[model samples]
Target: MSLELKDVEKKVGIDTHIHSTNLKLEKNTINILLGSTLAGKTTLMQIMAGLDKPTTGEIWFNGENVTGKEVQKRNCSMVYQQFINYPNFTVFENIASPLKITGVKSDEIKERVGKVAELLKLSAMLNKKPDELSGGQQQRTALARALVKDSDLILLDEPLANLDFKLREELREELPKLFEDRDCIVVYATTEPQDALMIGGNTATLLEGKVIQYGKTLDVYNKPENLTSARVFSDPPMNIAEINKNGETFKINNNNVQWKSNLKIKDGKYKIGIRPHNITTYKEGNNSVEINGKVLISELSGSESLIHFTNGKLNWVSLSNGIQSKNIGEETKLYMNIDEFLYFDQNNRLVNHG
Candidate 1:
């Protein structure tokens, strides 16, 4: 019970929407496809579901080639960003529709539908039509439909993206448990970083039609393979600046910051990467790289704050705990841990993993 895509590529006229992709999705675990819109997450999922034909390569399910198979022949289910349910049918009927088509016993359909609806918190709306339910309820009904059917593969294409923050959070928390015991392959496609983090699964980070990185979610985030992978996995976008090695000192160009490095490299240009959270308010007794800057913008998101500032010409950002009190044009002191830095070469390849 596995899904494999080998050298799968999708082309729209002259434009290649998905590059040659090779992936092996294991069973009983959620595999997340994380990327921005137009990054080819949906395109890849569609190919896997038999909804779209690959321009090249093959799709294998459980070691059997399933390329060019019709959607009906595949034991798969899909949920999209928009809520999709049979508007004319009651929630219970919608959930049982798939089973009914397969000539499942009415008694079994009722049991499965009831159990899934309860898990998705749609038990109370069993008798209501989709039009009569709220947005969240309608989506839940669709999810229940998918869950009721014993599909070996489930594709969730940003199913929670259209919901409110509160509802999305609630569902995000429940989804892991919802599929825990199901011995199937679940692939969830999402653009939000926190959504992938909350789901706690293996992640395939896509960028511009290619899978930039694929591994355990935290492993990929903490150690992205390259600049493209790092950029796609980043939430606020990692701060990057050109740097040059000058004799014994490495200078961050465009900013008056210099540090001594022991790494043996040619005295040439490079790029330095640092995440926003790594930058913080300056503190004494810490072996921190200090910098002076003027605040440009300050935003409070719940208990945390994000501060954007500039050290003369080079702009930087810092994400700090608690609400940051600062005004635009105010002078501020910032610090970065000496060890919390990534150095990249001119080709955007990570050179140092400090």
Candidate 2:
């Protein structure tokens, strides 16, 4: 079933927090709500799952208004970051608890629970308690419980945040598959950009309780609505620099930088943004605006290396793949990716190119 949020606004007190926002989730697709900590990711999910009421606005499911519906009344299952499983109950019992509460037959509950456990690789741990399983296993049991309920909507709140790197990778690959062919709309909230990209669906980016940007994953990543939205998704973040448009040329601190396109200068101050991967390091170039800097720190992570260069007053990170520099104190020349630069006005709004 499809889920839709219409002008939903939630406020804690006198402050007009979480303004009226709208979002829609297509049926049977994984819609990832990507944001950082305290970004209202969980708050929005809670409102959608009927755990909390919106101070203003409405929620509709399958074209029907279900705004005031209770948590259990809505066909939804929420899996939190912490695996909330009964300590005394075995894995099978935990998975079957929801079914039992709904008055499903014993035989059907056993069959459904067993099937979900096997799918999640929890079949062997059916007899084990929550304490007996590993962190990943416990998460899988929680996931199994959610799945066995046959809920129309599934809400995942940073479910993989506590797991080890290896386990996180494993479940990241398998979790999406769990909803395949099923008529359930999965709304997953995560801080990891890699997870959102891997899940690959409609993404809504929230910041400070506001829905800043929402669209296809790639489009939102490529063209963010504003500076804050741009910095939100980019790892190593987008490099923001100050620039001035003087007549036909763009100037940066008395130096004339080549303009990729003719820009209209309505404002005195302008912000330029570029991704780290888009930047290229050069040993020598007369035409390029040269910045002399010493390597402050160098970090190598297998295929890619992150080098921090400090040029007295300025410091920037350059991302390079399959390259290592041992010159920590030695000065090196840095080149800016002029072609890939994004221009923004003083208000932190992106300047339209076309």
- For each candidate in turn, the TM-score is 0.94, 0.89
- Tens digits of per-residue lDDT, candidate 1, 81-115, equal 99998879999999999999999999898889989
lDDT of each: 0.88, 0.82
Best candidate according to lDDT? 1
Judge candidate 1 at residue 232 and give its lDDT.
Answer: 85
Q: Tens digit of lDDT per residue, candidate 2, span 98-213?
A: 99999999999989998999999998889999999999999999999999998999999999999999999999999878898788899999987778888887788878888888
Question: Stretches of candidate 1 above 4 Å error?
Answer: 246-249, 260-268, 282-286
**Candidate 2: Cα lDDT at 258:** 45
